[model samples]
Target: MELWFTEEHTKDVRFTIRVDEQIESVQSDFQKIDVFQTPEFGKVLVIDGYIMLTEKDEFVYHEMITHVPMSVNPNIKKILVIGAGDGGTVRELTRYNTVERIDMVEIDKMVVDVCVDHIPQTACKLSHEKVNLYFEDGLKFVKTKENEYDLIIVDSTDPVGPGMELFTVDFYENCFKALKEDGILVNQHESPYYAREAAAMQRAHEKIKKVFPVAKVYQAHIPTYGSGHWLFGFASKKYDPINHMDEEAWNKLLIKTKYYNSALHKGAFALPNYVLEMLEQNI
Candidate 1:
């Protein structure tokens, strides 16, 4: 089997895998879901045929997505996870005892069922008693909820198909409404190396900043994502990531981490000069 990942100029990525002679869709039950097994990366999870996460490097995505905001505020009791079907974010969220309730709103139940059945390594923590599974639209869920969470993590896939609404300004406003006074929000923003899509991410950062006072953009490295460089949208009411680094708590939280430690957490924010310039210009 020969596998190739190509970054299309259309701002959408495509991964092609040829097994033996011809390529056939392995898992196609879900409308836009595509699951594939890779030699190096283990199981690759995709939605609408867009690659979301791979087994080998999923820790980087999950850790940065879940830990960055959680470590900043050690008091996040109730958390809302939007669009994390594979349970990677749930796994990371469960690490902290303070996280009592996780309202996971994923529209596609098939993604959760498939991952629960197939990807035990990633989905193990979603089965925890603290999680409240909501098989409904995240947009609608956010609209109805109020002052329920200390942290809201937007773990949605690329802004397409079922996840398109998750990227809208209306959704961010609802996230602001659903959060407590000192609530914080983080979303898996796309890659910076990919210019057009990165521009879209920059616009997203702009849109989020409009609703959340302490909105900022951060970075992470995940091998499965294009360019291996990812962005995270940080939105908060009072907490600031730069001023609120809890070194002791961060160290304490790292005893069980493989992909995220104090060093990696610190290094994730060290962006290149050009990227920094872009963010500055956007700001």
Candidate 2:
């Protein structure tokens, strides 16, 4: 018998990966966490039966999510990251010396601990002196903050289970209030290739547009994720991701990234006609 890990991307779609061995598995207070070592993707992290990241392609997701907003506004000093328990997002943010503080709010502590133990490649920065970890519900965390952060990254999981609330209009409204006048909020906006995820993506974009003055969608290809085509939401109070981008200034920092660059930054927002059509459904 062969042991494999499978994730249902939808009712009719499933992605499976061959597993060399199950490294670790734990039932956290919030969800089930598992780590597997594979010949193809190296170390893989799975949360609640959903693929979170893999050693092979995690860079694509992390870099695009962090560097896009940073390149657009390089002077951002304070950032609030909600739900990136793997610490990959914080690791990328810490590369900027201009970033003075990072407040990371994660709903589960076990996810962080497990990632720290089994997936240190991405979890290594969880204890950086600049990062303050808060193990609490992100929805409730943002509700108490107002005009406090220069950048807010909602690196949440799918809009299900504990993450369901993070996708609501109320949460986006609270995020709008939590950001400074020029703050930017970037989140993992699900894929558009599948109808199930596409519907969620459309709903997210529609709700965000209602709260932010400028809301746009960007794309990146991650092999382990659903359909290998992932979308991210960029919402800002005043700046347009492309028009306000400081390419010259960002390049001067000499930050090294595997999947994000000045050229890719501008091109990521060019959505296909089908994706554009879906995004324009109600907006």
lDDT per model vs. reference: 0.79, 0.94
Superposition-based RMSD of candidate 2 using all C-alpha atoms, in angstroms: 1.0
Q: RMSD of each candidate?
A: 2.9, 1.0
lDDT of 2 by residue, 1-283 (tens): 5779999988888999999999989998789999999989999999999999999999999999999999999889999999999999999999999999999999999989888888889998889999999999999999999999999999999888888999999999999999999999999999999888899999999999999999999999998998999999999999999999999999999998889999999999999999999999993
Q: Write the per-residue lDDT of candidate 1 for residues 1-283, one digit (tens) a residue.
A: 3655433435465545432221223443435655666666777766655667778888888888888887889888999999899999998888888778999999888888878877777899887999999988899999998888899999887776677898899999999999999999999878778776687687777788889889777787776666777888788999887678686886776547767676666777778887777766653
Candidate with the greatest lDDT versus the true structure: 2
Worst 10 residues of 1 by lDDT: 17-26
Best by TM-score: 2
lDDT of 2 at 50: 92
TM-scores of the models, in the given order?
A: 0.89, 0.98
